[model samples]
Target chain A: MRNLKMTIQYDGGRYKGWQKQKEGESTIQWKIENVLKRMTGEEIQVIGCGRTDAGVHAENYIANFHTNSELSVETMMDYLYEFLPEDIVVKSIKDTTERFHARYNAKGKTYVYRINNGEVRNVFNRKYTYHTSVKLNLDAMREGAKYLVGTHDFQSFTSQKPKTKSTERHIKYININKTGDMIEIEVDGNGFLWNMVRIIVGTLLEVGMGHMKPSDVGRILEEKKRSESGPIAQAKGLCLKEVHY
Target chain B: MRNLKMTIQYDGGRYKGWQKQKEGESTIQWKIENVLKRMTGEEIQVIGCGRTDAGVHAENYIANFHTNSELSVETMMDYLYEFLPEDIVVKSIKDTTERFHARYNAKGKTYVYRINNGEVRNVFNRKYTYHTSVKLNLDAMREGAKYLVGTHDFQSFTSQKPKTKSTERHIKYININKTGDMIEIEVDGNGFLWNMVRIIVGTLLEVGMGHMKPSDVGRILEEKKRSESGPIAQAKGLCLKEVHY
Candidate 1:
């Protein structure tokens, strides 16, 4: 079997996350696999690095699949490009070692969340940004995010109750920046739990809006309770920016 | 009557254009006017700077309306902001001189056309840019654009056949710039005829693609015939960037 690694970019607004669902539900993986079936006449089991919630976008999502087709990479790329939807783009594809699995080899990830903290929204970027009229306190949000960095058991940050799986994660950095009325929060980490990034963002937003103190973040993390965290932020503002192997 | 000058922005992907058409047709004007009627309980007529074609977006389009209601600008702004669709945003509103007309008083306007000149399109900006896999020669397009700048009777660069009306227009500048894979063409002019900017862009694209020589632009203008120009570019890539008073 020939292992093929691919770099993908997609606007996940109309998808049911990355994984394939029952039959009719649309997904990024299902879309590519469907296109590959037509091109190779073989059922291509494409593996994604990770799953992204509905309405989340991605810039450089990594994936891999094993195939027996002897077609050139360029020919397969051209065929896939012609068949895939406009919102989903296959940036590049190449041969890879058999053991270079997409999911297992992923070492780190970076995500970006955009907030339109302006009274007048940006019409051009309406879909990609979450609009909030309330003025956000930047310094406070930055201070709050600092508490979430570094390795710790982040049980308070996720939606699921991890009974057996360890919830410990090492967050490298959390950077909050504002340009014009757009505020972008970039988070890089070794791993993330279900709804973890959104919950952390929500807690920071609470601090920014003066509802919670920056010290509350440390308290919430220590509590190890899901109810201690803030509400989950909207999925539309979140984007999978990078995946490092 | 208070002559209110308002700045508006919209993603014109969904609308037919800026003007109100039939009773059921949706347009920027119709959307705003409908909101005003609900707010003031009066039939309000909103005048736009000019008409934009279908799927054309705007960033800082100027418009005006005469209202009899003694409502504060902020109150009206809030009502409009709350009621208008998310794709349309009323940026600002203020009382202007009674004689200040949106269409007639305009001194000049600036437009921007974006081209995604890359093998793989930017998924986030798919709606805002025109994607062409053909590698464009930037220097050639710039060279062709120079011939169209400055004062000239652009008879061949418009869709409408002007008989007695003056087709003379003073084009201030036409700048072509490339950053990463995005190429932006900015055109500043005193006024434009129907589809003049679109036709001009189409001709420049033809030059960039090596279909026509750069000098052909000069000859096309000299011919003063509609058939001499290239095809009209797509409306989605065009945006009304600014309107000068």
Candidate 2:
């Protein structure tokens, strides 16, 4: 048996998400597994580093799978590239140790959300950015992002109540930058809860739009109530930029 | 009647082309005319600055139409924005003189062609760039581009025989630039013949790939035979960047 580690990139616009489903819906994982099954002539299951919500893109997603196929890594990479859909690409493939686990071995993750704050939308980039003509207060958004950094329980930022043993997670950094008419929010963390990044972006946007105050994030986090946070930002603007091991 | 001048942007991946077709094919002009007809209750003919081939995009295409409607420019802009498809956008709209014509009054035009010279294609920008894995010689391409500048009869560069009174056209400049793994060729000229820009790109790419020498471009231009030039590049990589008046 050989363990294969792969770096993947996908445009998740047409996919349900990264995970396989019982309904057999189209997903990035399902697509790759289907290709692998055909190539290896065996049922193949791929474990991803983490799950991304529907319509979220990824530039450097990591995954690993165990297979008994005798094909070389170069041959497998070439075959996968030839068979996979244009939106999903296997960037690199390599043989790894049997002990390697994609999810458990992941030490950190980074996500970036894009907002097109221009009066006129960019037609070419419409799929990847969320459009908003409303003027955003960059300074206020930056101030609000600071509160979300450091280790804390991000219970209020997720959709459901925490099922894990603890909701405590360390957010290493939060950077807000405006380039031309596009504003990008980049967040790095050890782990993220369901919809946590999107919800945090929503809360920061609310503060930028003057609907909420920067200090409100602290109170919301302390309360640990989902209703206290801002509405969940659209999934289309969010992209899993990197998975660091 | 007021002559309205508008700047348009579109992702032409799905459209047939910029010109309206008699066979009821979907075109950018047809879509805009349909919206104008419904809004003004009159047969509206929109004349664009030039025709773009199928799958070719535009960033600052100019167009003009005479409308009898009493709607303000702001209202028309809003209506167009609401009615047009997500891939098309009206960047700006203003009133122009009666003597103005979209095709005839244009002084110069700028076009840009992008090449993804990377090992892996960028899925997010797949529709907008042409991918080639071959390492390109930028200095060679730039050397070839210099020969195409200034006044020249570029009959060999165009696919169709010149129907105009003169085949002479002046190329103002050609700028070849590389940003990361993307190569951009920006050309500015008084006017372009059909398929002229694509053919020029094809020829330059040949030089970049070391198939042709840089000085061969001058000889190809002097021959004035279309067969002497390289094949026309794909339309997806070409975009009308600006229309200068």
Candidate 3:
């Protein structure tokens, strides 16, 4: 068997999510698999770095799979890109060991959430940005972001939905960059739970808008209860930047 | 009567163009008129700076209308923006003297055309940019652009379907900027005929692709025949930058 690693970038606007679902439901995995099947005439299973919710975008996502097709890596990548829809693009492909799992072997991940804090609607960025007509205090947001750095029990930030693994995860760094009418929050973490980044963004927005104090974030993190966290932000503003091994 | 001069921006992806047509066919003027009528419950007419073809975009188009409604500029703008869809935005509103006209009073107009000279399709910019997988020669394009900047008849560059009274238009300036896979051509002209910008772009592309020599543009311009021009570029790549008076 030949193991392959693929780096992907997708708009994710028309996709149900990254995983395959029941028949009649369109998904990113299903689209990729369908394209691969057309090219190789064989079933190919693709394992992505992680699952992104509907409407979420990705700049560079990693995936791995095993196949025995005779097509070279370059030929397979070019063929797949040509066959796939315009919304999804295969950036690069390479050979990898069979034991490297895109998810489990990932050493770090970076996610960036964009908030359009402007009075005018950015028509050019309407799909990729979440519009917040309400004005925000950028200084207060950066101060709140400082409290979110470092490893901690992030149960309050995660959703109450069940998962197969532990909820505790390590957040290595957090940076809040605010310029003009756009605010981008970059989070580097070992792993993120379901809705963790969205919840963190929601909490920071509350602080920025003066609805809650910066110290409120520490209290919520200590509560270890999902209800104590702020509201979840929209999925459209989130982008999976990179998954590193 | 109160004269109003307004700056407009639109996606232009949904309308039939700038002018009103049959009932089923939507146009930019029709949408603006409907918004104004809904706000004041009075029928009004709006005159635009220029007519853009269907699927073209604009950032700072100008328009004017007369209204007896006693609505403040801020209030009127708020109602229109709130009522209109997200794709259209009214940047600002001003009360102008009756002598001001959006079309005749305009001094110059600037247009920008975006060409995505890349192998991959950018999903976010799919609707706004023209994708070309073929490589272009920048030196040849620049040489051709140099020949296009001058006052001329422009009859050869225009189409027979415009049916305008005159085809004598002057091009004041032309600039080309290319960065990696994106090439933008900015044009400043006294006036433009129907599909004039699209035709210019098409002819320039032919020169850049080595299909025609740079000197061929001079001959094409002097020929004053529509058949002498290159194929018309698609409407998606053109954008009305601004109308200055």
Candidate 4:
């Protein structure tokens, strides 16, 4: 058996997400597995680096699977490219060590949230961004972001009921960039709980709108309560940018 | 009564073009007229500078209409912005002289066609660009464009069967720019016949692919027949960039 790793990019507008569900429901993993099973005549199970919610796009998602087929990586990639739908593309494929696992071996991840601050919505980019007519204070958002860029208990930033041994995670960096009427918030972290990124973005947006102060983020983190944070941002504006290993 | 000129932008993926057609079919002009009629309780007819084919987008389309509504220009613009569909946007509106007709008094127009030369199709921008795997010769295409940038009978470049006495037109400029995997062809002309811009783009594409030489454009123009030119490019790749008065 040989282990193969692949990088993927997908527009998740009409997909149920990156994980397989029921037989009839469509998902990114189910689509790939169905194609591979037909091509190789084997029940192949593919594992992704992480799970993404519905309507969340991905630019550089990673996955790996084991197969007994003798075909070259390039040939397999071509077959996958031809069989996959137009919304999902396999960027690259390569052979990997037999012991490598996609989910377990991941070291970190990065995500980006986009906000369209233009008064008039952009017809072309409406699907990829959250449109807001209200003007946002970038300085206030930057100040709020600074308080959350270290190891801390992020229970307040996630809706997931804490059942794990630790709810603490290290946020490596948070960068806010503005180009024209578009605002992008890029977050890099060691790991994240469910809905953590969306919650953090929502809280920061409140600060930008002057509803919350920069110092309020420190208190929200210390409180370790989900209700104390701002509402979760919409899923359509969140994208999984990269998975680091 | 006042004559109002409006600059509009739209994503034409779901529209039938820029003119009113049958009762059920949707068009840009029809959408605007419907809103105006409801707002003023008067029959509204919008005259566009030119008609765009089905699935052709517009970044800056010009149109004018006469109305007796007493509302200020800004208030009328706000009402249109609030009521128009998300795909169509009114960029700017202002009062213009009664003699300034949208179609009859136009000085010139500009159109842009986009081609994606990347190996992998961009999922995000698929609707806005036409994708091709073949490598294009930009220099050869530029050479061909030079022949078309002057006054000539463009009957061969248009699919329309002209009834007008003269088919001569002045092409001020044709700019071919290549950036990364994107090729943009921008054309400025005194006027254009039906399907003229698309056919011109198709002929230039053939020149880029080495099927037609740069020198063949002069002969094609002399022929003055539609069959002498290449096929018309797809409508989705063409956009009305601006109208110069």
Candidate 5:
């Protein structure tokens, strides 16, 4: 069997996320694996870099699989392009070392959340942006972002149960930039827990709108309680931007 | 009675077109008029500056309507915002001269067509762009575009029947610009016949792909036959960008 790595990009608006589920439930993994199985005549399990929540998009998702089929990478890519749905695309495929696991790779990930700070929605980009009418205090948001940019147990930022394995993760940076009424919050970390990025974005928005003080973010993280964080932001605005190996 | 003009923006991915049809047909005008009728308790008719083909988006579409309702502009805007589909938006509404007619008092319009000259589709923007795998010659397209800038009877560039009133229109400019994998064809004209912009884009694309020479464009215009032009381009890639008053 040869290990094959695939680079994927998808508009996850209509999908139920990346991981495959039981029969009848739609997912990005199921779609790709179904196509791969047909092409190779083998049951394939696509190992995704991570799971994306429903309605969340990804720009550079990586996955790997093992197959005994001796198909050329170009032929496999063309097959995927023809068989997969328009929203899901396999950008490239390559032979990889057997030990290269998509999930267990020692690396980091980057996520981006988009917010439209316009009084009215941007008609063209309405589907991908979280529309917020209230003016955000960027300076305050920046101050709050600094408190969370380091190795911390982001227990309060996730919906995952406390009994789960280690919640400590190294956050490399959280950059907030605004351009023409659109705000992008980029978060780079060793890893993220379930709903962690959404919850973090919600908390930062609360700080920008004066619902919470900048220092409150540090307090919430120390408390390690889900209730201490703000509401989970919408899934449609969050996108997995990059995976560093 | 008062005249009100609305600056509108819409992603026309789902609608039949801009014009209202007989009952049961989905249209942008029908949706807006339905909301206005409920808001005003009076029959309403919205006049658009021009018609856009189905699946053609618009960034700054202009429309005017007459209503006797005494409601404030802000209240009407809020009603429209709440009732209209998420894809369509009224960016602004204003009181205008009673003689203002959306179709008659218009001046000129600018449209843009986006072509993705990439081997793989852009997963995020696939819905808005036309994907072309063939390499386009920018210098050749620019040469062809030069022949189209100026007032002329564009009888050869439209799908409209020849018996139509007049095919003459003033094309102010045709700009072909390439940025990375995207090529934008921006056309500015005083008026356009049915399917004029699309057919023009199709012809220019043919020129860029070496199927036709740059000098062939002038001959095609002189021929004044619809069959003399290239195929009508897809509507999804076209967007009405501006309407100069």
Candidate 6:
């Protein structure tokens, strides 16, 4: 048995995120599995660090899986890049310890959400950015994000989905950076719940746009209710920046 | 007659190019025309500075059209932005002199082509860049480009499809800048022939890769033959940077 560590990147626009689903429904994992099965003539399970929502994207996402086939890690990546859709890219593959797991043993994760704060919509970048067309107070959003740092109950931020039994998580850090026409929110955390980042973003956007007080984020966290937070932002602006282990 | 001056931008990945074409299917002009017709209930003819090829992007393009409608420039641009597909944007519009022409009155046009010179493909930016994993000899390419600046007969770089009466054109500036994993080629020309920029990129790429000598570009120009130049670069990497009139 060989442990293969793959650094994957994908445009999740046409995918049902990263999880495997029905044959007709598209997924990043299903596409990878299909391509690997075709290349090695053996069924291979491609595990991802975490699942992204549909229309979300990734730049450098890490995933690992075990295989008994003779295909070398480098060869597998080369073949996968050639066969996969242009939107998906397998950047690198390497041999790892047999005990390596993409998710269970992860230490920290980082994500970046882009907000287009420009008055005009960027036609080419519409698919990847959240168009606000509003003048945002970045300092207020940054101040609010500081309250989200450190380990705490993120129940107000996470969705009450059936799959998630618990809402507690630790967000190590959240940094908001502003460029000319865009604002980038970078969050580092030990773990995140369903829609946690988007909710945080939505909440922060409200604070930035003066809809909510900057200190209201602390109250939302303490309330431990999903309805207390602002609306969840669109998934398209969210990106799985990195997975760490 | 009200002359409307419009500033436009588009991601040319899906269309057949800027010019109105009947054989190769839909073009950007046709789509804009359809939207304009829908808005004003009248046929409007728009003239652009130059025809950008299929898959070539534009950040700022100029166009002019005559209309008898009472729509304000801001209202027209707003409506166009909403009406046009997510890939195209009408950034600004203004009423201009009746003598204004997008093509004939143009003083200079700037074009940019991006080459992603990296071992790994960027998944998020796949559609906007050309991936060339090989290292390039920047000095050699720059040397070749120096000869391209100034007035010259660009017949060798022009494609021979529908014969144009003249192929000679003046290029005002040629800038080759390489940053990290991308190389940006910027050219300002009085006017470019069909496929001229793409072919020049191909020739410069060959020079950078040591496939063709840097001095060979001068010979190709002197030969005045399309076959003498390198293969035309893919249209996806090229963009109309700006049109100045």
Model 1: DockQ score: 0.87
How does each model score on lDDT? Answer: 0.93, 0.93, 0.86, 0.90, 0.93, 0.87
Q: After superposing candidate 6, which stretches have Cα over 4 Å from the reference?
A: A21-24, A161-164, B161-164
Per-model DockQ against the true two-chain complex: 0.87, 0.82, 0.62, 0.65, 0.79, 0.79
Residue-level lDDT of model 5, residues A1-245, one tens digit each, is 89999989998999999986678689999999999999999999999998999999998999999999999999998999999999998988999999999999939999999999998998777778899989999999999999899999999999999977889989999999999999999999999999999999999999999999999999999999999999999998999999999
Give a tens-digit lDDT track for model 2, residues A28-114: 999999999999998888999999999999999999999999999888888888899899989899999999999999999999999
For model 5 chain A, the run of ten residues with the poorest summed lDDT: A16-25
Report how far off residue A201 is in candidate 4 (Å): 1.5
Tell me the docking grade of candidate 2: high
User: Who is ahead in TM-score, 1 or 2?
Assistant: 1
lDDT of 3 at B217: 93
Candidate 3, residues A1-245, lDDT tens digits: the string is 88889888889888887886688678878888888888777788898898888888999989988888889988987898788898988878899987988988999899999989887777778888988879987788778777778887888898856354577778888888878899898999998988899999999999988998888888888888888888999988999998978
Candidate 1 root-mean-square deviation in Å: 1.1
lDDT string for model 5 (B113-212, tens) is: 9999988998778878999989999899889988888988899998888866888899999998889999999999999898999999999999989999
TM-score of each: 0.98, 0.97, 0.95, 0.95, 0.98, 0.96
Q: List model 1 lDDT by residue over B10-116, tens digit each.
A: 99999989996678688999999999999989899999999998889999999999989999999999999889999999999999999999999999999999999
- CAPRI-style class, candidate 6: medium
Native contacts kept, each candidate: 0.88, 0.74, 0.41, 0.44, 0.71, 0.85
Query: How many pairs of residues collide in model 6?
Result: 0
lDDT of 2 at A8: 96
Best by DockQ: 1
Give the per-residue lDDT digits (tens) of candidate 6, residues A21-93. 5676788888888898888777788878887777789888788877788877778878998899988899888
The residue pairs that clash in candidate 4, if any, are none
Candidate 4: tens digits of C-alpha lDDT, residues B205-224: 99988999998888898889
Off by over 4 Å in 1: none
After TM-score superposition, what is the CA distance of residue B87 in candidate 4 from its true location, in Å? 1.3
What is the Å distance of residue A123 in model 5 from its true position? 2.4
Error of 5 at A11 (Å): 0.9
